[model samples]
Target chain A: DAGVTQSPTHLIKTRGQQVTLRCSPKSGHDTVSWYQQALGQGPQFIFQYYEEEERQRGNFPDRFSGHQFPNYSSELNVNALLLGDSALYLCASNPTAFTYEQYFGPGTRLTVT
Target chain B: EDQVTQSPEALRLQEGESSSLNCSYTVSGLRGLFWYRQDPGKGPEFLFTLYSAGEEKEKERLKATLTKKESFLHITAPKPEDSATYLCAVRGTGGFKTIFGAGTRLFVKA
Candidate 1:
């Protein structure tokens, strides 16, 4: 079965610009979660979506938002990006909202200049 | 405050050398501990999960053990293929989010 897949493996954006990253969850999975990983740091949870609605969120600011479609695909959008926003954006999926294991995608590296 | 800390920011060993990575955590309520392996510029791959104290899980040459306060990933007879950053995370009591550690970078030289 195909695992979680993300689009535009790598991207470069300018400061003050907005960017949107896409993620397709693993087959048979329904819950999708977003995370941001800075260099040398572990991924910090951004938000989680289930049943096309956001169910949980992390400590990130309001500039970070996401949407999950009926097909269980997700999109992560960051507005007014700062250089600090440059990092690896990851997407994870689980079969259930309360599942113990989360399968992660390869992630998209966002570089802000 | 909830926090997860991993020891040994980086480690280098010979092909046959073995070592252990530590993950220390303190959360409001402990639900589970998770381990992941990540390569350069890639997302993490799940390794193992420990639900309770004194529990252990193994996959190939990698063995993971857990306690109430900390968890360990022991590598046996490591190989160059084992080179990657090992990350540890814990599921929060809320059941909605997870807390992650900074991770330990391991490099196996042949």
Candidate 2:
């Protein structure tokens, strides 16, 4: 069975531009959550998507948004990217929102220039 | 606010040596504590999950034990391959969001 997968292993974007990262959750999973891992720090939650709607969010600003499709795939979009936006974007998925065990993808490294 | 803190920003252990890493958390109505191993440039790999105090889980040379406020990951006779960043996270009764710690970087030298 395939695990969670993310697209565009790496990306480079300039300030004021927007970027979208994609994620396919693990098979048999339905909930997708996004996280940002800055250099030398642990990952911070961005938001979570369940039932094709955003269910919960973290302390992130409005510029960070996400979507969950019917197929359980997810996309994280960051608008007006800043230099600080450079980080590793990780996607985690679980069978349900209440499930504690989440499987993660390889992650997409976003480099804001 | 829910928070998690891991001790010893980094650790260096010689091959065949044994050591333990710590993860301390403060949250309301604890649901579960998770342990993950992350290699350089890779996402975290789930290691173990502890739901309550006095619970313990073991895999290979690693063992994880949980208490009310803390958890410990014990590595026995570690090898170079065991070198990686160990992350601890916690979930509360509020929602699905899991708060994570800064993580402990482990370097097992051969």
Candidate 3:
């Protein structure tokens, strides 16, 4: 089974612009989470989606939003992006029964110029 | 608030040398403690999960142990290929969020 897939492995956007990152969860997984990892730092949770609805969110600001399709694929959208938004955006999938067995995608590297 | 803190911001070891990374957490109630290994330019890979205090799990040269307040990832006889940043996270009770630590970077020189 495919572990997890993401689109546009790399992207660049100017400050104040908007960007969208995508992810397809692993097979048989119902929950998906997003994280932002700065260089030389661990990932920080952004939010989580389950059953096509946001189930939890982290300390991120209102500019960040997300959508999870019925198929469990997810998209992360950022509005009025800032230079601070530049980082590796990660997508992780987890099964309800196996909470700790999260599988992560390669991640989309977003660079805000 | 649930939080995880990993110690020894970075470590360098000769190949075959051993070391341990620490993760301490404070949560209302613990659901699971996780350890992940992340290579440069890649997302994290799952290493081990300790569900409760005194629980231990192993895979190859890596073993993870958990206590009520902290967890440890012990790498024995590490190799160059094992060099990576080790992250620790916690699953808390009554919440869907998983809090993560800053992580420890390990470099094993062959």
Candidate achieving the largest lDDT: 2
Q: Whole-model Cα lDDT per candidate?
A: 0.93, 0.95, 0.91
Write one digit per residue (lDDT tens) for candidate 1, span A19-82.
9999999999999999999998999999999999998889999999999999999999999999
What does candidate 1's lDDT look like per residue over B2-84, in tens digits? Answer: 78999999999999898999999997887789999999988899999899999999999899999889999999999999999
lDDT of 3 by residue, B57-94 (tens): 99999999988887889999998999999999988885
lDDT of 2 by residue, B41-74 (tens): 9999999999999999999999999999999999
lDDT score, candidate 1, position B35: 97
**lDDT (Cα, 0-100) at A1 in candidate 3:** 83
lDDT of 2 by residue, A1-113 (tens): 99999998999999999999999999989999999999889999999999999999999999999888999999999999999999999999998877888899999999999
Q: Looking at model 2 chain A, report the run of 10 residues with the lowest lDDT sum.
A: A94-103
lDDT of 3 at A106: 96
Of candidates 3 and 2, the better by DockQ: 2
Clashing residue pairs in candidate 3, if any?
none
After superposition, the stretches of candidate 3 with alpha carbons farther than 4 Å from their true spots are: none
Better of 2 and 3 by lDDT: 2
